[model samples]
Target: MKKLSMLLLASALALSLAACGQGKQTGGVKEPAQAQQGDTGKAPQATSKKTTYPLTLKDSSGKEFTFAKAPERIVSLSPTETEVLFAIGLGDKIVGVSDLDDYPAEAKSKPKMGNLQGNPEAIIAANPDIVFAGLSLNKNSVTKLNELKLNLFQTNPKTIDEAIDRVLLLGVITDKQDQAEQVAGQMKKEKQQVVDALKGLKPEQKKKVYIEFSPGWTVGKGEYLDDMIAIAGGVNVASDLQGWKQISEEKVIQANPDVIFFAKGVPNLEKTIRERSGWDKIAAIQGGKVVGLDDNLMSRPGPRITKALVDMAKALYPELVK
Candidate 1:
């Protein structure tokens, strides 16, 4: 029971903070063409276009933040933001990171100030020109930071496309436009790759998918994971529900997903899920199609999201994707 609760809290922290809106179920995202790959696998040298200064843009919160020039010092309270910042070549400008922002190796050595519930004084003391935050930040923390006049830029990306948009937006504000575009281009290519692979799949061929981010918890319609399932050429059986919600075993038995995916950290994922009472008749359990996906890749809404998308497609249509 304790472990299940912990998993639920963790899922909320990882997703509820970053995702906005219920599942839009766009089927699949049709992104613009990816940038032509260079000989070095880098985004080809982009034209020297600069983000003219005195720039103003809105964060996911719809709050406008203006920058006189590129911010020299930065603080990030979201792990996804940390990854995006690094992807855009802004690692050196980071002054502080949340305790949990361990990624890309370099972030591990960054000054650990706080996370969603970080102390306002420590962040203010870091003297960061801007702080990247998300909905995970405690209401008290946000209030205090707002009172202190901190430049808190909250990012809420509900879908893979919006996540890519965030990468482009961060690049523009920090004067790393080329790097950001390259990252976005790569994401688009990844998305297109999965789409191309599933082109021959008919609506009838699409599998019914059920994903458990945590024990007793599953994503339904209007959530990022549900959309990912659609993009990967499958339908979320729980699409009838909305957002992240606790699911009942009876529901799983009735919906009978063709494939089931769970967060990877759990031990004996297949056995654990298969043994659930009344689940013996489930198609996924009988066919041994239970899959364990990397929790981090499944959770974070950043450059790695497409990796999850690719993974989901591979799991559903292994013969096609490979």
Candidate 2:
């Protein structure tokens, strides 16, 4: 039970991360003009202006940050934020990243700050103009980072759409509004294409999905993966449970989902599932429908989640999505 509990905690922390909400809301601390909210499979309109400085903004924690100028050096404690920063052309400006920031090939080369709970001493050593953090940060680390008074900010997005807004919001902070618009615009369009393709899918038409992202751990409602499954025209058999949970092998055998998604890099998950007693009766295993998705794509809530959405939609309903 101790190991199972640890796995559950790790699954939640390892996967779903967050970011900012919509920009252009009426507020004192403001961001650049936002792109259209309705996803119509079109690129966001380009704005000629950049993010104006003396920028005042709010982090996901509802803490405030004021930027006197576009930060020349940045440290990102969130892997998703690192990816979003890179997407908005701020890659060159980033001086450090979380141990987990591995996308785009370039981020991997940056200096590593510890993981979600950042290394405050290392962050200070990097001499960042600003710092971006993830939700999984431990309370102690949060207090230490705050005590050090390091131009700190945070993002904690619960959904993919929220992730898009974070991409735009980061632009607001870094003076990369145009690049953010273009990047998020592409994300919106790609996601809309998936939605359009899956439109009017009846509950019965959708595949029943079972996802085990970590060993003995799965996600349910109120989290990104379940939301992704729904958008992809699939039903989560685990939705009866809440966010990130230890799996019940008996329940899984009973639900007998049509498709099973396992995080790609977790060692031997597929093999374990296949070899598990009484799992042979599950339709997915018998039909060879178990799939492995890229762990980063599935875990990190960033601009690339749209890519994950498209991939998921295609996986479940290839005939419709294609």
Candidate 3:
């Protein structure tokens, strides 16, 4: 009876161990498959959270610019770019500005890097991620900075449309696209309104204009000023000239403009024209059709151009404005 009992006990113990082994196998097989499914579900979530970089581009003047990443600190080599940055609500990101950037009252507090010929060392010390320069910047200076792997944007805006485009570009770089769009939109609307208001006038009624800078210095044909004058309901008398050139009194007399625009504060302008030798023979001088343009507003590439255009339109077409 004891031997029989031992055999039965052995069989029971073996069966119990067998069952435990099966349970362990079942758990091990199921756990990995369930965990793998859980891991697969999480992978897409992480991938979707990835951040994108900003776009990179080269300006019209061949300066390389990257906007794929938002820069924490920026420098403006051109006064116009500095003013543009501030205009686009990037005052906080601007660490340094050129001396000529004086429009925004808040910009005065920022460090000035002198003029467009600003010291590169001062700019480097600022540790800016991006730099803005005008197309007129000395090429050697721009090349030196570029060799150091510094990103730069060179703007050369010759027309009002180009100026507005610069503002939009700055906004994109600084992450202020909405505000920039709004400001540019308003300027465009105001400009278009002025253009539409004067569209009804006859060509004969339109005055022929000549923009005189100095005794001999005058805007050539196809310049931005010429475009502005045409848009303001005046014909450019010097449109025949090749480019910005020094015109002789004979040329001015031959053009016979009905109106003359003199940029304000030009040295020896009034005195020179008064003694212009043969300038009085021109119809503009004889008819008192000379108008002076504010240097600050008309000369810079900014929102002020819109104001300049509107003012010029009103001045040239007083009857239309009324």
Candidate 1 or 3, higher TM-score? 1
lDDT of 1 at 207: 95
On residues 197-217, what C-alpha lDDT tens digit does candidate 2 reach at each position?
988787668889999877778
Evaluation by lDDT, superior candidate among 2 and 3 = 2
For candidate 1, what is the total of clashing residue pairs?
Answer: 3
Ranking of models by lDDT: 1, 2, 3
Which segments of candidate 2 are over 4 A away from where they belong?
1-47
Better of 1 and 2 by lDDT: 1
How many angstroms is residue 300 displaced in model 2 relative to the true structure, after the best TM-score fit?
1.0
lDDT of 1 by residue, 45-87 (tens): 4354466667755566566666888889999887778889998
| Arranged by TM-score, best first | 2, 1, 3
| TM-scores of all predicted structures | 0.85, 0.85, 0.77
lDDT, candidate 3, equals 0.65
Best by lDDT: 1
| TM-score for candidate 1, residues paired by index | 0.85
* Residue-by-residue lDDT tens digits, candidate 3, 1-322: 2221111111100011122221211110011122233645664221111112445455656444445566789988765666667776788999998775667788788888766656777888888888877655667877887787777666665556666766665665566666777777877986897889998888888888887655566665544566688889888878777545677777777888877877666665666665676778777789776778765555566666778788788878777854
Which residue pairs collide in model 1, if any? 22-222, 23-222, 23-223
User: lDDT of each structure?
Assistant: 0.77, 0.76, 0.65
Q: Clashing residue pairs in candidate 3, if any?
A: 54-68
